[model samples]
Target: MVLNELGARINSALQALSKEPVIDDKAVDALLREICGALLESDVNVRLVHNLRQNVKKRVNLDELAASGNKRKVIQLAVFDELCSLVDPGVQPWKPRKGKPNVVMFVGLQGSGKTTSCTKLAAYYKRKGLKVGLVCADTFRAGAFDQLKQNAARAHIPYYGSYAEADPVQIAMDGVAQFKGSKFELIIVDTSGRHKQETELFAEMEQIAAAIKPDNTIFVMDGTIGQAADAQARAFKESVDIGSIIITKMDGHAKGGGAISAVAATGSPIEFIGTGEHVHDLDPFSARPFVSKMLGMGDISGLVETVKDMQLEKNEDMMKNLAKGVFTLKDMRDQLQTILKMGPLNKLMGMVPGMSPEMMQGFDADESTRRLRSYMSVFDSMTEAELNSDGKLFDTESRLRRVARGSGVRPVEIQALLHQHQQFGQIVKKMGGPKGMLGKMNPGMMQQMAKNPGAMNPNMLKQMGGMGGIQNMMKQMGGMGGIQNMMKQMMGGGDGPGGPGGMGNMQDMMAQMMNGMGGMGGLGGLGGMGGMGGGRR
Candidate 1:
């Protein structure tokens, strides 16, 4: 029934051609018409879609497929491949070199999150333990300084913006100079958003770049703009060395593909993406997933990346625990916590192949994750033997009693966790890590995760089993617990380069995850939730 969409769309257009082997002018025209409608409805750029149709018509050998009785099937594959090629599978937003202090210059129409992103970038770099500096060069807007200043405060980094300075370029120059010889390894300039007419402002930005000679220049655009992305990206590209782009407001945009597709022509890679106004809402942009969705295909690579990036340095602990073939109540707690770090689990799951959108429509992703997290908290209250060793929680009576006395949760919740862990055990047992840690991990991201901590779920932590809980956790981990324990819990079993112990503690993970997610100012929903783990909902 489901294949009917792609199947039916193809068949309806092929009826006349299917009856005859050679698809002449009429049949070819008909097939193109069907595809054109589908592409246009999906919010694809009209001219782009038209161009694609022309290419497909010229290339596809309709007569051969019709003769083989597989015209529709062959046609679908061709359309899919062409569409995929159009999207460009592996375009990353921004991947600055290790030691290069990437100067990601932010640009957008007014109120598209430039100031917010600047602080987020500063925090991202800071968490990486890189010396980070901020330049509030957006002197044009009424309250740009106040806005950017507020964000800088959230990140707890230094910033230079002058109300009297008037010249944005000068402010950037001063900001760049102030951090010289200091710890900050990365410098982000928060420039004011302007219209195409502002050539003077563009020249000023050139002056700033000439002064700083930034490693990367990022263009921040609102995700809601769709096809207009062409004009916006072009305007910025004309003025300076626009190296990358960031698409913001993704959490709310309904027709976001235009903005997603428009920048391909600019020769500028989209580096960071903003989902919301929150600082942690920023993520490195990858084009594969966005492209796959447009063609109605699943995006497996994004899932792999999210899982690899989400787990900080602690997935090793999970692997080690799994390798030992052990699953404790504590391990269950940690597993659930790890899932939180892995992010809105179901959404991440949706990126996997065969994960149907219709299937997701039935199951509420956020609510289910919340239920699972609560179950994990309940399991956390059990004794060491109950958590670590087998048979301690074997009896249903013990499970019920443990649930009631410890986390104020129900027995049913505990039952579910144990059941799920059993399933997980079976799954892990079947998996063979071909490259082992090298197979499952992203080296750069893993390194960053080791340094950054997940955000705090104030309400969850406050309500779940109470104060000094983190202290208790630290004690259980024997003083080394805190973040290292969490990271070990994250990457414990993995043989990745980012294995723990080298990772410092919560302070580091916090800075890093904050910087990676959206830093202090962008701690909204899943962004900050990535760090909260046990505290996260």
Candidate 2:
């Protein structure tokens, strides 16, 4: 991940404070404000940010901590703890009932993963030794029943539905009846997603939901939808008692933030996430890792738990910030911390489909951290005029010099900070709107990143993580020490027009081949197993 503005902000603030002998309130306030801003940018909810800021401030009283015999080291620990606490770290075990077809209904607008979700859920339960059945009730959309049928067949589950029946409620009722006393113990009802706006269809949907009285209701959603999650979720939430959600197509480039996190603002929790098109990709949802990914942080709860079952409450806090467009320096800094937590810069960014190793190479983590510390110093020295007017620093050379003097960095470094901020601002603008070339810049973003040299900074990564097309697994892997060395051993370093050959066009073919396997772990032992010449993972 490129160190975009958000990461820069957090890194700068954190570094500055890390050097301090005492935890100054002034410094904390600036850092908190920076965090507040970044959280908002990520489209997080407002009240949460307000709560986060207040809580962080309350816990960061250097005088209090110091008086309590808390050392400077502990102060940083307290900071991280306070923030992590806000995110609520923990995992929820899947609590399936003892008996009966734990009736799960997957619902969402058209094209959401409802159809595929039914099959995935069925397969999950089937593996658990429960006989699962499927009922397709989508009469409005053509071929919806067929799709469900095919998926059910693939899952090796019994399915009951009729295109001939007009009443979906009857079909659902019959599905349960047919499964009764049979081998199937769990029955999933697949309903066609009719937008909440469609009165007649929605009415039928409501009737169907009522008739089934499902044990769990899952709303499937596409991941590309960003801050609009609240509105979209609110649209469907009122009609049915939404038990949970399944975020689909996350394997695609779309940011899984909104889809997986509709619960963030809507008060609904996610139950499943579609990892890929294949049968095994449906994953149970908790919240920790998904939220951690959104914040560009590590899975504090542990990787396996996050991958298996997701909810970690603090996710609610993070999502609230992203929805509101408050990308704070602190939030940026936290992401930088995440990078450190995840290892080397290039390897971290390498996991992103669009992020080239070259871009990762361009980032000098030490220099960047040092520059960020210097940047924070400059910001610290800024007068109210400069703080309110980010652009004014450009014309106010003497003032800028004063900032430089106060921060103990050269005047030019302050200028460089200003330049970085400008580039950061442009990238943010692009991210806020069409994102045009800037949006696609990270991996597919390469061509775009080339046009905008500024896109390689901290802010871009934060926003792109929101925009999608990258694997957050890299962020975690990079920070975790062993993973990097492991990945280094795993990385193919040769040339075969693909693999490590660095040929761009062949990457897709390579990606497909890689996807075929469970993961890169299998390749770790092979330094030279493939036909290519570079390093083999």
- Reference-based lDDT, residue 350, model 1: 42
Q: Return the number of clashes found in candidate 2.
A: 76
| Local accuracy of candidate 1 as per-residue lDDT tens digits, 238-308 | 77777677767765625555665656656666666665555655665544454443222334444334444
What digit string (tens of lDDT, one per residue) describes model 2 on residues 421-484? 4443342343323433223323323322322222244454554453232233223223234333
- Candidate 1 — worst ten consecutive residues by lDDT sum? 528-537
**Prediction 2 global C-alpha lDDT:** 0.52
Cα-based TM-score, every candidate: 0.67, 0.54
Question: What is residue 66's positional error in candidate 1, in angstroms?
Answer: 5.6
TM-score of 1: 0.67
Q: Which parts of model 2 have CA positions greater than 4 angstroms off?
A: 1-22, 67-94, 252-261, 289-480, 495-537
Best by lDDT: 1
The lDDT of model 1 is 0.54
